[model samples]
Target: MNLALAAAALAGTPNDSHGESISQGVDSKHILVSQAQDWVAEDRQLQKSTIEVAPSDRRLIIPVCNTAFEFNYPFASSQKTLRAVCPSSGWQIFLGISVHQSDNALRYTGNFKAGHQLTGTDVELASLSSAIAGLAGDLRAIEGFSLASAVRAGDLVMQRQLVTPIEGYRLNRAVAAGEIVESSSIDSILIASATLSAGQTVTLEQLDGARAARDLAAGKVLSSYDIKKRHQVLITQSGIPRGHPVTRANIALQDYYGKLPNDSLQNYRSAEQMQAIRNLAAGTMLRLSDLTPIDIIRKGDNVQLSVRAGALEITVTMLALENARLEQRVLLLNPESGEEIQAIATAVGQARGLSTVAR
Candidate 1:
């Protein structure tokens, strides 16, 4: 994945009382391949020869990740204008909902270097106020929000009131080291296709340091003229059938000050029920997730699931798919039958009229 296309690799543990449970997950994370019959289209920067299976040929469809959505985050016209921008668009969100110690800290890094340097500390309040308000508004809506930056310190901090009346969310995590930990522009988002080299390695590009700054130095934070980033990732495996992971990765980028960009950012997901009807009617391509599995009744008879929205709209549909893995022994009856047929499964969806769904 090019930096422009995808990003995120989770890490960090929320320092709190429940920290024990927060630090580790029941299972360590590892990349797995899936979809043996299908071909693999190596996504981003991952090379695969494996497949990842959703425990039950299904996984709980939790709302996660966002991409094009960030592209829509309405650009804020410098902070001075004081326009009450609510961060309604453009800015994308990487919901590090994982309370796991290794997944709590949100990381943000892009191309921007210390925002357009100002002539004086007094600059304009309107723009800064707008930025603060915009920043604060976003904090209020998202839970446990933290502001990371390369320049915030002392007086440059974002107070709770600036974010929301809600008491819980705030920039509480202090930087233990450098400048990159706090600033939005200092964080880095990467995308690529790579083979397995290390087993879940945590690469700390910058040492830890002071958290977000509320103050500033004379020089601007450095940045390349053209930089790209992202928070959502799609890992596709290589080899036989290959597999794809619809997941959110955990990652963070800290600058010289240990500061990361803004963490008050948010990501969104449309519920299954909501997308199904449209897909069924206009032939919309509903998320594969929305399809719930029904019981298998008979041979040739399809397994059924519902495409629904809320409790009101539900469309029952057929889902027939074949899945088989090579068992130890071969088929006995067919004497002449060759080695064992590892996997076999038929897939039948309500594809009859689903073609029109593609955008």
Candidate 2:
């Protein structure tokens, strides 16, 4: 007789009528089913109510084992099939099972059109079975993604239906041609259009020292080709005559987007104590070679010559023999003694004697 049927008959037969005890033999089928249920609950971390075990056939019979039965999953590489083995008896049986887990997934709260960017209000978490939830991608990251196609209310948000937004910078206000592209004047934005790619966008660091190449409208997305590095070059605001001082009043620093000459002057301090070497028109870019150090002493000028010895000093008026700047050596002629002296030009009309010689 089948073990299942015999177990059922024994369960139905009264002990007094059969004059036999209920524990005469073990029910192998019941043991296998109980063991499979316990395995699913413990190993799979599934609730007993969520696990379903198929009923054993009443005609199927499994021999009772003298030792403990070992259990394993033998088919589909999953916990669906539970194989219970009677090691001592060399018999085993396969049982089928199903596990259902409840999970949360993101779904559209209302109908949305294509190209619509998902916001917090557009999606909500909804309870769903594992089989249905698996179809949806990560629920937490669906927000801020643009929809590739229209979606209806209560539809689950899926990875395939999303178009990642292209991140870039946009001008907060209109920028005129040749104006500096300041980081504070632009705002970061996301473009939801399918036609744009990430490579077409520009980053904030790329905008450093950048200027607009042309007139740009407000809220327009900026690209790498739309901006150029701003180069600073000194420009004359008014015509500077030759021998005139190159001061801040006449020359101003201007921003240039195009390439500048290698000799262009970049700082105002560099032009200190310098004079224009040639006539420069208004708005002309200043170059290093265009200016010369201002001469503190001019030829044929009378300069005070000072001679110093141990605890003694002598001052005399002499004629400068050559044009010289401060700290430059110049020859001076002594009118009374007809003597020549080499001295360093100290001021506009002053010189310090270095050595004396007879003419």
Candidate 3:
């Protein structure tokens, strides 16, 4: 391929045709320019630009190759030597162009508080500056974030200045002082079981179960007082003997002053079976601490033991050595072998275990 011919082919001016004789069907210059534009547009780093591409003023003519045209460099950009080549032709030409960004990156529309979550309307594109020179012109880079410090209007919002918004609970409407904070008025929640105290965070479930202990302003963060702590206790209608099951009929709601356990009296309202640990007089508050779970198997009682090993299960009558609750492990004496084996109490008077040698 002749250098003169390559110059002639690339020449934009028609009067200075040096190698016009070279085969010219498709405009290789135009194709190279188009390919160069595409290269810049597809570039991951250079895509954010307004590229102005123009053919060089010099003339060059080269043999048109059968293969596709390509750039000698991996990328094309402004003020860079864009070497377009026809691989099969073994020739290439250089062009000079410019890539410019039309505007600055992120600019604030108005003063923003430090904790305010950034939104699309809060910022807009403006002239590019060194402050935001490295930042991309993307809303996603800043949206949903808050400012690390207060930003004045028209200030450049830098990526380093932005921070992820911290998640917290807030009220949707004004809550009266001492009014119960309901689920409907809360924007977010945290789960907890304690009574609301002043400045102590409370969850919606805890609030829904309690009344406002004091006057609480609307939107004010809830404290311990926002939640009423009184809980209903199972009271005794009559003397409940030790080991006797406590039913709802014998209990009533009463204000409790102490901290309740995770398994609070609220659980017994569903009518779950619980028994007294010791004898209690009539009207005694049936605290959970004073109650023991019902015994499914009693001491010295004859119970059927389901001795199991993998898939095989065998039944043997055994005498329980001690009282056991549901799923409680109990010692049983296998009468036939005269051996005491440990078995889990499953049902009333029914125990199951794996067979073991007498000990």
Candidate 4:
């Protein structure tokens, strides 16, 4: 019998006869060749294709498996060989087979360095052998991909060697270390196809209030590590006494570029109603921990208590029961009525009753 018919017969193909006996185990070589043929037919979608298996030891035997055999192509570039494994017996063998080649593949038109962005003119589709056809990815979809490694002219273009482009920000001009990065400093949004060795690139939103952490060249893609948040900290222009309120006269906004202190105050408005917790020297960066809310009224101080009802307002003297900051609720004692009441501190020596007293 011919090699193809013998392989099929050994792999349990039914003969014209009803029943046959005298089974003496299956030949290992025949099983390998049969499985290789099945792999090409099923995986490669080739119908009745001819497959030539290399000859092995004629004495080699493989036990008949109750379950189906498994075949796998181990090489990525070529399907010239396959591994046949018997699941039940754990018997495995490698078999060499012939596979026809006539597939289209993309090849580089000229030598290109790593990071070179691919264009339509850079590659062309050409007929390649099936042994290496798997390395040639979808040729029509490879445009705009960047090369991860250098490739020579006429070399097969591979999917594994390409990187997809991403959108990121690029610098318009060279920025020195410690310089603040503004919106004008960004040239444009870059569609980066090149592999980034320095890490992920930055976005336009990240440039809102950022400063360069190091010297960067023009056209360089900005990474998160390359920039820091630019801070506008409130710094004391003159010595401030403890308990003194932080005002524009004693403090000024200073541009600070670097890592910011966790407690550093950024807005002057926030500091206007705060008092120094301790004596602060000139040029000290104001921090949240170094300041406390200023007291608008002190304990035992006489304050004007205003009560209003239906457009009628009456002011009376009331004694503060506790020191309180603006908008803080404070306990007050009405000297005339000798009654304790809650009022909101409005200003120095001034308190407003919580509810309108109907005259």
Task: State which candidate has the highest TM-score.
Answer: 3
lDDT (Cα, tens digit) per residue for candidate 1, span 1-359:
01121112223323445534323321211111122101122321223322122222222111222211121112354211111111333222221111111111111222212221112231111223123322222222334322222332223323331211111111223332223343433333221112112332122222122233333332322221111222222111221111211122211122222222342212223221111111222212223443222221223334333333556644333323332111211111111332222112222222111211111
Candidate 2 segments whose C-alpha is farther than 4 A from its true place: 1-185, 189-211, 215-225, 228-233, 247-249, 252-259, 311-313
lDDT score of residue 103 within candidate 2: 72
Point out the higher-scoring one by TM-score: 1 or 3: 3
Order of models, best lDDT first: 2, 4, 3, 1
Off by more than 4 A, model 3:
1-35, 42-103, 126-136, 160-174, 182-210, 219-242, 247-260, 263-274, 278-290, 297-346, 350-359
Q: Write the per-residue lDDT of candidate 4 for residues 1-359, one digit (tens) a residue.
A: 12221211234322323222214234444555676687778887665355556545444444555566798876888676666777776766666666544666788999998767788889887875554734655666787677888999999888787787677777889999878887888866425356664455666766777888999999987878889866689999999999888898999999776678898998877787789989999999999999999998999999999988879998989998899999999988887777787899999899889852322
Q: Could you tell me every candidate's TM-score relative to the true structure?
A: 0.15, 0.43, 0.55, 0.54
Question: Which pairs of residues collide in model 2?
Answer: none
Off by over 4 Å in 4: 1-104, 109-114, 128-140, 148-194, 197-229, 308-314, 346-348, 354-359
lDDT tens string, model 3, 210-273? 6556565566555554557546655567888887888767766665543566544654554355
Q: 1-359 in candidate 2: lDDT tens per residue?
A: 01121112111222342222223223655666676678779877767777666545545444555777787767666656666666776666666676655675788999988767788888887776444523454555876678888999999877777778766688899988778888888987776656355555667766887878889999877876678767688999999999988888998999776656888999998888788999999999999899898888888999999999988999999998898987999999998888989999998899999998766
lDDT of each: 0.23, 0.75, 0.64, 0.75
What's the distance in Å from true for residue 30, model 2?
Answer: 30
* Strongest candidate by lDDT: 2
Off by over 4 Å in 1: 1-218, 221-359
